[model samples]
Target: MIKLQVIGNLGKDCVVNNVNGKSVINFSVAHTEKFRDAQGNQKDKTIWVECAYWTDRTAIAPYLKKGTQVYVEGAPDIRTYSTQDGRQGASLSLRISNVQLLGTRSSDGEGGSSYNSGPSYSAAPQHVSAPPSSSQLNEPADDLPF
Candidate 1:
């Protein structure tokens, strides 16, 4: 019943795989923290989280590219194994329940653009249908003197 959420930039493009008739998207996210060390020296540490999203909705997979920011939530999992040098190492992974793209690094390499799952803003009106004609009226207008 433990849940974890991470907001960070994608390390690379997502991979969509078909395993036993089920589709799964795999990706990695990196979060960096900045702090001042004991000697007043600035330091940065990065944490990488591997994510696996199993769902039929693969439309979002195309957009999960490198340097793309996203928010992901899911059940946390820790995997421990022995490295090639006979050293024990552990990695953090998640079975994603939900994910959202936050932004994308701009093509110009200057900044980035924000993203929203909701509808975009438009200056024009959405409904363009005309009003009902007199023949379509259910009831006549009330006739009264001013």
Candidate 2:
């Protein structure tokens, strides 16, 4: 089995469609890469990935708008086709299995908050919930489970 995961900002708003009684939400994520070229020129390459999330609940469609950052994991599908000009082109798409609402505007917060939860990816990743301090993560040699 092959799995792919991508974390990036949404390129455009999502579309919810009802196909054969199943709800499907379609969106796209833009993953970018920055590197130096052979001539020592910095180049930025962005790849767009179309994602389809199939679920019974269409409740989250409203929040899955443009610029909303998302983390998606699923199977990668590379589709090839000929362009109108007879040129060849390919697109990247994903069949999503999991979708999580990281954050949303104050009114759209998944969990009620004093104020709407802001952006989810603006900050670096870390353990935010109340938990034992780092000491627990760096415990001395112990005998529990290897």
What's the TM-score of every candidate structure?
A: 0.76, 0.69
What are the C-alpha RMSDs, in order, of all predicted structures?
Answer: 7.7, 9.2
Worst 10 residues of 1 by lDDT: 114-123
**CA deviation > 4 Å runs, candidate 1:** 111-146
Find the number of clashing residue pairs for candidate 2: 1
| lDDT at residue 3 of model 1 (Cα atoms) | 98
lDDT of 2 by residue, 78-113 (tens): 999999999999998999987665544344654433
Query: By TM-score, how accurate is candidate 2?
Result: 0.69
Q: Can you tell me which runs of candidate 2 are displaced by over 4 Å?
A: 102-146
Q: Alpha carbon lDDT of residue 87, candidate 1? A: 100
**Model 1 C-alpha lDDT per residue in residues 85-108, reported as the tens digit of each score:** 999999999999988777777676
Question: Candidate 1 — which pairs collide?
Answer: none
Predicted structure with the largest lDDT when compared to the true one: 1
